[model samples]
Target: MNSQHAQHSPEILVFDSSDALASAAAQRLAAAIVSAQSDRGVARIALTGGSTGIAALRALRTVGDPIDWGRVEIFWGDDRFLPAGHEDRNDAQADEALLSHVPVDAARVFRMPCDEGEFAGDATAGARAYEETLRSLTPDGKIPELDVHLLGMGPDGHINSLFPGKATLSERERAVVAEFDSPKPPPQRITLTFPVVNAARHVWFLVAGADKAPAVAKAVGRASPADYPAAGAQGRDGTTWFLDKNAAELLR
Candidate 1:
């Protein structure tokens, strides 16, 4: 493992293998959550979904850290606009990986509104409802002050459901939006907008696999957000990119 501190852009943490990356991230997250709980009564985290993200969650479950799950709040970075329990949804993955095993307050597990029921399978309705929920979390109606916001980078430089060249990348006011026409399947998705994602106290990117190398380079290079959505994500306090050797290969 090699950790490099950067003065300008996000610090890059490179690991020999994806497993090592996930393990290190999980350990750090456990420490962060414990520290936050000591400073404040509660801790909040926005979890991401993907191979690497799930690995980290599982790793977190194994940590010996005395985390009071009951005092923690959980949220997702994004979810597929499918049924609440759909296997493809990020919420579903989260539950299987860590949520179901933890005793977090049910009220604080803020899962995104999925298709069906009152949402009527309308992505737009779910997006609006999520925005309303976010606004209600804090008194000032601004986006919630996220403790840790985890994200996954797509091979094309997308984050959450915000893809490169998508008009949603230009969105400013909305905290959440319905992502339509996504390059990936199950296009309809509910994703946190840039303004909200960038509001986090810390942003962590979990990226693995050789396919992500190009995207990593572009994101850290001169590519615009319009061309690489990942470039738009900036944490208020700090941003860290956790990468496996393959993913960091092209990160010159």
Candidate 2:
């Protein structure tokens, strides 16, 4: 949250194994939460879904609870526009991973709308309602700048459902959008646009496995956002790529 670490230009932290990566990320996240809350009295974080992301969250539960979960505002970067309790929903996975283990205030956890909610199966309305909810959190009617935006890079250089070659990658104004034809299954999804994601104070890309090596390379290489959406996740304060050995192979 604060620029306390040495400035090493868009840092990359590599770990030996996926479990170790998860542990280190959990510790780093705890530090950020403590630092932000100490400086601002509240910390805002955007959570991500996916194997590695959920693993880190579960690891967060293993660390001593240094964060005042009550004062922390929790949000998701993207979510499947399905029923609230659907197994594939990001919020459900997150809750199962860590949120349910903490004493975080229910009101502070902002989840995207679902098929059964007031928005009811309308992904566009879900996106609009989530954006409005974000705006209401600040006095300026703008999306809140997250202290930490935890994300996972997909095999296709995607971040938060903003897949490669998708129209959402070209968006510059909206803070959030509903995607109707994601390359992955359960096509409908609601995602925070690049404008909101890149505006965060910190962005941590939690990636693992050899399957992501190529995409990681493209994300750090000379590629447009249209071709590698993950490239657009450059945070305002700092951006860190947390990778396991397999994922870091190409870069090495």
Per lDDT, the best of the predicted structures is 2
- Count the clashes in each prediction: 0, 0
Q: Tell me the TM-score of model 2.
A: 0.95
Instruction: Give candidate 2 misplaced runs (Cα > 4 Å).
Output: 1-8
Error of 1 at 95 (Å): 0.6
TM-score of 1: 0.95
Instruction: State each model's CA lDDT, in order.
Output: 0.88, 0.89
Q: Which residue pairs does candidate 1 place in steric collision? A: none
Which lDDT tens digits does candidate 1 get at residues 1-252? 011223257889999999999999999999989988998888889999999999999899999899999999888889999987999999899889998888878999898998889996689989998888888888988778788999999999999999988888888878889987988999799998887788787899999999999999888774888888887787777989999999999977
Candidate 2 residue-wise lDDT at 115: 82
Tens-place lDDT per residue, model 2, 215-239, is 8887776367788888767777799
